[model samples]
Target: MVQSALWDFLRGQFTRLPYPETTFTDQVVIVTGSNVGLGFEAAKHCTRLNAAKVILAVRNLDKGNAAKRAIEEATGRRGGVVEVWPLDLSSYESVKAFAQRAMRLPRLDVLLENAGIAGPPYRLAEDNESTITVNVVSTFLLGLLLLPKLRETGQRYNNTPRLPHLVIVSSGVHYFTKLPEQSAPEGKILATLNDKATANMGDRYNVSKLLEVLFTRELAARSPLPSQAGNARGKGGVIINYLNPGLCHSELARNAGLGLKFMKFLLARSTEVGSRTLVHAASAGEETHGQYLSDCKVSRVSPLVSNDTEKHGGKLHTRIWDEIVRKLEAIQPGIMQNL
Candidate 1:
């Protein structure tokens, strides 16, 4: 595992990820965390590709508007709309409000969940550590809340040659973390993570990414979409997948140490390069459903997920999903029913 991940990382440093060639012609897309970094570049690409409506779901309206102008000027987008809406993933109320507003949109064709934090010191938001709350809990909650809209858009645009996309920007860093919290009692994984005394801050981001991969796997198994890999793009249901943008020159590692800083200097891909992977996954075929993407293609997930002997992935995936579902249900009654 170590040798292979090292090889991929070393190769990825010099490898230029393919920029997206797929156009969004008349699609309506929402990109979270679009105010900067990978989200900013991904949103720009969507606008450049001619998405009919590109909403920058951000925490700060001013920065989002600024990014909107930057994208408009950069792309010279003629008639497509680019607007900003507030979304702070730290709070369930904020995510719920954002999802509520999204459901009212004329049609949601793509939901690019590109916002996440890494390497921050432990802190509580909504009674959990900030990273777990924002990265795993609120992230999935927002996706779950908006599932109906994505399904609705899929049916509404049945004749169109596109499927509604739910793209979560996960990380290959998940390969290094085996989710030690899996040892926690089945229903208490998040709760255990929230207890700072037992938390390992250095591994928080990686563990959160692992949770994202697990939950996406669980969601795909339970969604109305075909679980088989060969379902065509516009044939079945919403396309949900997680992505790894590689080590990138982005804001994700703002709090890392000097060793990582030096590694990033030699190994990080440009955010522009990394963001294209997000755009590529957004336009990908239905085969990507419940899959992990890297460098613009379907890639292997960590063996902890894939080497399961049990049906429906493994026990860890379902255990984490159940804990997350319970948490989400506590936050908002009946969120899982949206499926």
Candidate 2:
């Protein structure tokens, strides 16, 4: 397995695959953290595919506008094909505000939750660890908050035979995480993660991603969408999935040190190549709901995440989801009602 993983990692370095020829024609798409790196490339692809409105949700409007202009210049489809919206993943208020604006739109066909932080100095946001807050908490907050709009779009287009999509950006590094034992304790996981001495900040990002995968699975199971079991084409309501971009050459790791930078320079896939996975996941059908995707296909997850009929059952997955919902509810009262 180690050798196979190494081979896959090496192949990712040379991957130059183009975005698939899927047209978003008239669809409204939103990409978070789109000011630079993979998010920016993905937004560019969305415009080139003809999305009517591609919102670049970022923390800084200035950088967002610059990215929008660059994408417009590259795609040559100007005149508001791309719009900048303010979103700070570390702020609950910001997420709520962004979702409010999104609900005002007549249609929301796709939402790409691409914004994330890799490694940063220990910090807290909204009473939780910074990485967990931004990567897992606020990410889901905005996603769940926007569900109403996505569901509305699905209903409006139900007869048209299409479902709105929600795509979460995850990482294969999740497989490397051995979740903190305290992370399993009720009402204590976030607090435990916040404790700098006990928390392995190096692996905290990976743990947050593992939480994302578990959340995706639970969310799909709880979704009103019909199951993809018997039907191959998949019954549609709102399709949700997480994807691994594989060691992409992006600014996410800019702060990591010279050694890591040298390795990335030698082996990382370009942001454009990595963004193709995001575009593919966003355009995929319901069959991919709750699955981890790599290289544009439904890929196997780590044994730690694999579903088993007996051993431990689904308790671990459920525990993580319950904790997440509890934390989110504390941030926004009655937020569970939205889900």
Candidate 3:
């Protein structure tokens, strides 16, 4: 079969375009699941630019270390500045520990909540929450936990003029799903059921992705407000932006089973091809804030996502935030204060 013209165009552009230059030099980037796939590729770009530090936050310590070594070698840096921190996005306790430890370090310049699980059969987290918790809630906790450090980075450099950026690597899947109007039920009730009960994996994943976008927009609105008011002298804007990296052949699909594997073999882009959107969002200038990016350009997201209609997009945002706060509070009474 002949490939679609759009695919051909994207393929050509993806191949000939040079990798984006080091826009994040001397910056600190924390990439969850940076040991492999698009996260690893993004981390490479950070090191190439001489980032002050790149933290490979992953659940697998060995894999994280190996990726760090590869980055250091490829960049030809004399010393290994990239280090690994163990983190599991599925459990609230694990998320708490990871965030608390990161808080003690110097302020972070960027937090890439890139780790995610896709299309796994229904599995319960330690807290018995749904896979959405792993994909969405845990990420929220991690980002919120790092807020103070991210803010401090902004505050310390507010005079210098560069804003700290947080990039959320979400998927286009959210175009088709909707968030719960209320809390996520109890325990793993939502997680234990297959997509049939909570829609399909595609729907669940899409809902999670939309949640990320809402969180980013809301966070961005609140963050810059205080600083803009001049209440804090050293305040800096914590810009949150979201991007969809398109399908790539990576462990992200390892559990998608045989059909997905075969499809990916034919249609999926390489990890490098998929990382462009992410790299751009992470390094783009101030003009790119709060935009949904794809194909290395700022483009309109699906109407279902950007829409503000109560029946569609608008209500979902409020609902997601409410659920997020509810879950976070359940996990820890006053965690939102740090955020």
| Candidate 2 Cα errors over 4 Å, as ranges | 1-4, 15-18, 159-161, 182-184, 227-236, 307-310
Name the best candidate (by TM-score).
1
Query: Cα miss at 45, model 3 (Å)?
Result: 1.1
Evaluation by TM-score, superior candidate among 1 and 2? 1
Candidate 2, residues 78-181, lDDT tens digits: the string is 98789999999988999999999999998999999999997858888887889999999999999999887887887776654457899999988777777865
TM-score of each: 0.95, 0.93, 0.84
lDDT of 1 by residue, 133-216 (tens): 899999999999998898888877877776888999999888898778878875888889999898999999999998999899
Model 3 lDDT vs. the true structure?
Answer: 0.71
Which candidate wins on lDDT?
1
Higher-TM-score candidate among 2 and 3?
2
What lDDT does each candidate get? 0.86, 0.85, 0.71
Supply the global lDDT for candidate 2. Answer: 0.85
**Ranked by TM-score, top first:** 1, 2, 3
Worst 10 residues of 1 by lDDT: 227-236
